[model samples]
Target chain A: MKNWFRAAMAIFWKDILLETRTKDMLLAILIFSILVIVIFNFAISPTPKMIGFVAPGILWVAFILGGMFGLTRSFGLEREGGALKGLLLAPVGRDAIFYGKMAAMFTLMMVVEVIVFPVFAVLFNLSLWIPWLIPVAALTTLGIATIGTVFSAIAMNTRAREIMFPLLFLPVAIPTIIAAVETSGVAIRGVELAEMSRWIPFMGAIDAVFLVICPVAFNLIIED
Target chain B: MDDKPAIEINGLTKSYGRTGVLRGLDLKLDWGEVITILGSNGSGKTTLINIIGSLTKPDSGTVEFGGIGVRARATSIRRFIGVVTHEHLLYEHLTGYENLRFHADLFGISSADERIIIVARQLGVEARLNQLVGTLSHGTQKRIAIARALLHDPPLLIMDEPESGLDQEAQGMLDGVIRQLAESGCTVLTTTHNLDKGTAMSRRIAILREGRIVYDEDLKSSTGADGVKKAYASHSGESM
Candidate 1:
């Protein structure tokens, strides 16, 4: 268990260093998310009712689209120099690689969320300061990162990698997206946690299922 | 160090679609031995190395390391083997030092700093340690790849075309490194198209043709590079 954690952290650290040096994925996700928010702002008028009705969908659109961009580029550094092969050659268990990659993607998505969340609140004129918003966002992002990391690895080697990722990722992600949009709506409207209790547990269930499945699936995809 | 062979392959076979790559191939390497495989293009040299490195699966047969089959204990077997392929296998955006450090951490090397420094100095890459691998020349990248391979002090070293992009000095350093590893009782299996260099560095040389080893001769009994060249031509049906 200790070795597994060490290996996972090593991979996590490598990704962090590479992302910090290049800022490629972070910048792409940030720009694409900002564009999404700005376009939605123009497409929908700032009327309070309109903002309240469309805000959840727009916020999730930014996150899902921005996450797609980040997911597509998750393995870019590894593919650039065939460094994935090096990681595979290590004695570490395959689960460690999966966890490390998931952690890195989760961290990157969270950083983007931190920036995008405030902008989203300002643009939509919604109160996002509710205590439940943090847990809701964390749960939703965890689901996306878990599912996205596995599909990213699968798509990294395909010839139509750009087109392949969404086709494979989106269908599996519908449950998580629904949960996120629903819960975000509750948080945006300042609904009591008891009102969202049902949806929050559903989101947690989705996260739990993928959290158990993705690492196992990752092992199969990466094997010879 | 033990009586058992460091690596043993029996009836190893692999194919891609209808095209067979390795067909019932068999080979063995005793501990502390250096064996170089020389082959023409499409001779399945890289395929064999990939299988032994646990990066690819064989269609049939078995590869045993220290008498344990690779199929049953791949993860554990990987702990004992180091691989250096044609690909540098280093992140291009990362500096040589960072790349080596990452690999060391993956291998669970406790003294990673000392190991990286030693290997870098031995490969004459100490000066280039801080440079990003992508910005360096191919030969320098190869040196970093070698350093990464040696970081874990694996008992078995598998390399594919180790001398492909290296200059004379780099090749000399590689030769010295191989000799030192052999002296330290590590088994080395490498493939190269350079008959002269392959024969000179390895104690035993095998010529691969049509997915099978057609000719194998120990350097102790063979004349020199001329003998290896003639053997390769006669077996592979190609002139050097």
Candidate 2:
């Protein structure tokens, strides 16, 4: 178990360092996410009552697009030069690979969230005063990335990788995305965390299910 | 420490849809031994290597590594096997030092910086350690891949045509490296169509034809023109 943890951390660190140095996925995700927010801000006329009606949907749009952008590029380079094969050759267990990749995706999404929220706070002009909402945002991002990374790795093996990712990811991830947006909007609207107790449990269930499912699924897909 | 077979395959088989690729192949290899496998383009060489490496599961038959059932304990069995295929298995964006460092970390080896420097120097890649793997020459990339494989120092090394795409000098250097690896008590199994290099580096040569082993012989004893002709003729199903 110790070795597995060590190995997973190593893989996680490698992804973070690689992405940071190049800024490949982060750049694309930021641009697309900002564009998404900008379009939503301008295209839809924001009235006092309409803010509550559309804010949830707009935030979800940004999250979905940004997360999918991340998913497409996560394993792209690894597949290209056969680095995935090298990873397989390592002595570490397969579960470590899944967990390590999840950590990388989780970190990247957090960075994007940090950038997105301040802009979101200003644009919507809603007082999201609750401190715990930040942690909730991180959890939602984790849920998005955990499932997205596995599908990205799978799509990397296919020919049309760029298109395959969003097509496959969006359909399966709808429930989680909807739950995240609803709960996040509730927090932003000054509702107590307890008001989201029902949805919070559902989010936890999604995380738990994918946490177990993705690792088992990844092993099968990665096999030659 | 016990006298366990380094690799054992019993009636291994693989197929693609309706077409058969490998049919009931059996092999046994011991530790600290070198074996060369030669085959034509589509003769199941890669399939056999993939199965042994646990990259692909076999359709039938069983493989045991160091007396541990490969299918049952694959994750544990991986500790004993290292594979170097034709694929350039180094990440292109990562510098050589970072790449090796990452691999060392994957194996959970502490003090990775020291080990990375040592292996980089051993492979004559110390000068290029900071360079991105994509910018390195094909030979240098191959060297980095070999260094990555040796980081864990698995007893069994399975290489598929490690000399491909290398110039004459690079090939000679790689041959020396393989020889040195063998001398250090690492079991080496390699596949190559180049008879001279295969014969020089391997004690035993197994010639594969159309997905079957047609000839397995000790290269030291095999002599002259008749040996070469007979081996080919036998594989071709023609009597000479």
Candidate 3:
């Protein structure tokens, strides 16, 4: 048990070190999100009333698009030079590999979200920021990273993974995204924390259920 | 370890879709033996190698390493197994040092950098340790790959066509390294196409044909290399 956790941290640390050196992945996803915000700024007129009503929809569109772009290429790093095989051969548990990768995906996705959310607020005129959205974003991003990391590994095996990931991922992911947008909409409208609490449990449930299933799925699916 | 064979496989069979790759084949190697497998392109050499290395599972049959099942106890067995396939299995974005370090950490080695440096020096890649693996040339990368495999001083080493991309000096260094590892009681299973090199590098040569080993012999007699060459020609129908 102790060895398993150590091995997982090793993989996670390796990923963080590589990302810090290259900075290419975060840069690409951030650029895409910022461009979406810029285009949306030009495409829509953000009056006070319009900002309140349309902000969640526009924000989620940007977040989901950027998250997909990031997750699509998540497995590319492992696939390059057959490093995934190296990981498989490393005497580590499949759960360790899964959770380590999911953590890295969660971290990268959150960084993009943390940066994009503020940039998004400036453009969408959403000055009514609340601390309540932090838990919402955390739960929702965990769901994306959980499902996305699994699909990223699964889709990476396909010949046309760029197309296959969304085809496989969107149907499952839309529920969480919709739930996130709905709860986020409530927060944007300055609702009480107790009101948003109901939807938060559902989002957490989605993340919790898949968290257990994806590891088993990953262990079975992982093969040469 | 001496009481049991380092590797044992029996009634192993594997297929992809409708195509059979390995028929009910069997092979065994005792502790500290170096064996080389030679075969034609579609002769199931890689399939056999991957099975022993635990990279892939056979559709049927069992493979054991030092009394442990390869399929059932893969993770436990891999702690003492080092594998080097045609692909280097490296992270191109990480420096050679980092790659070796990460693998060392996974294997739970103590003083990992010290072990990595020792192997890097032995492979003559110590000077390029800080360079990103992707930036290195093929021979340099292959040397680092070799270094990575040897970093943990595993009891069993499995390499497939390990000499393909290496330069003459690197190949010579590898020959010496393998000899040293064998001297230290490491079991080795490797595949190669060059008969002369295979004869020189291994104690035994096994020729694969149609998903089975047709010829398995030790180089003990005066004309052993010549006899094995002739048998290889007859079995594989390929002149080297």
Candidate 4:
């Protein structure tokens, strides 16, 4: 157990350091997400009353789509010079590999979300006091990261992995995305964390199910 | 210490689509022994190496390493094995030092810095260790890959055509390194089409023909490449 944790942490830090050095995935993901928000700003002229309803959807669309892009390209790093083979050859358990990768995706997606939120506030002309939305978005991001990491791994060796990832990931992830949008809508409406009690438990349940199943699924995919 | 053979494979069979790669092949190596496998292209050398290293599962077979079942305990068994193949298996963006450090951490080595320095020095890549792997030449990258495989000082080493990209001097250095490792009681299994290097580096030579080992012989150290060339020609059915 100790070894597994150490190995997983090593992989996580390695991913972070590599991406930091190259600005490869992080910059591309951040730009595309902001581009998404900018494009939606022009397309959707929501009335003040409808802004609350539409902003969350647009926010999540940018988040999920940009995240999907990052998730799909993530494995290409491992695939390029066959770095995945080196990971497999290590003594680390397959579950450690999954968690390490999942944690990296979760962290990267969260970083993107942090930068995107204020831009979103400025563009949508809303108060940037949606602190409660962080937790809501976090729960949603965990679910997306779990599901996206697994599906990205599945599509890794495929020829058209970019297209295949969303096809496999989005359908399974709709429940989490819906929960994110709903809870953000609640948080954006100036409600306290206590008011999101209903949606929080639902998001928690979805994240729990994903956390339990995705790592085991990753093991089966790699070993078999 | 356990006294079983270092590696044991029985009735291993693998196929890809309609073409069979390994057909019920079997081979064994004892502790502290070295064996070189020679085979024609597409004759299952890589498949055999991959299966032994636990990179790929066999269609049907049982493989054991030091009395431990390979399929049942891959993660634990991996601690004692290191592999080098055609692929460099490296992250191009990270410096060579970082790549080795990452692997050392995964193998749970506490003294990662010292080990990385030692292996880099051994491979004559100490100067290039700080350079990104992508910026290095092919031979330099191959040397780094070799350094990564040796980073953990594993008991068993599986290499597939490891000398392909190396310069003549580096190849000679690798030959000496494998010899020294064998002398230090490591079990080495490698595949190469180069008969001279094969005969010089290993105590035993096995030739794979038609998905099976048709010839397995112990060398007398003075065994010349010309004699082994004839044996290889007869068994592997490739005109030398």
TM, every model: 0.98, 0.94, 0.97, 0.97
Residues B1-240, candidate 1, lDDT per residue (tens digit)? 266799999989999999999988999889989999998889999999989988899999899999988868887788899999999999999999999999988888998899999999999999999999999999999999999999999999999999999999999989999999999989999999878888877979998888888877887787766888888889877777
> Which residue runs does candidate 1 get wrong by more than 4 Å?
none
When sorted by DockQ, best at the front, the candidate numbers are: 1, 4, 3, 2
- Candidate 2 per-residue lDDT, tens place, B64-86, comes to 88777787887777777878888
Among all windows of 10 consecutive residues in model 2 chain B, the one with the lowest summed lDDT is: B224-233
CAPRI tier for the interface of model 2: medium
Better-scoring candidate (TM-score), 1 or 2? 1
lDDT of 2 at A111: 86
Clashing pairs in 1: none
Least lDDT summed over 10 consecutive residues: which range in candidate 4 chain B?
B219-228
In model 3 chain B, where is the ten-residue run with the lowest total lDDT? B214-223
Question: Mind giving the per-residue lDDT tens digits that candidate 1 earns over A117-162?
Answer: 8888887777757677788889999999999999999999899988
Report the number of the highest-DockQ candidate: 1
In model 4, which runs have C-alpha deviations exceeding 4 angstroms? A192-195, B221-224
- Report the CAPRI category for model 4: high
lDDT of 3 by residue, A1-224 (tens): 88888898998888878788877678877888888888988888788877767788777777777888778877888898888888998888899999998898789888998888888888877774667788888998899888888899999899999899999888889889998888888888887678677898989898899899989888888865
DockQ of each: 0.88, 0.74, 0.81, 0.85
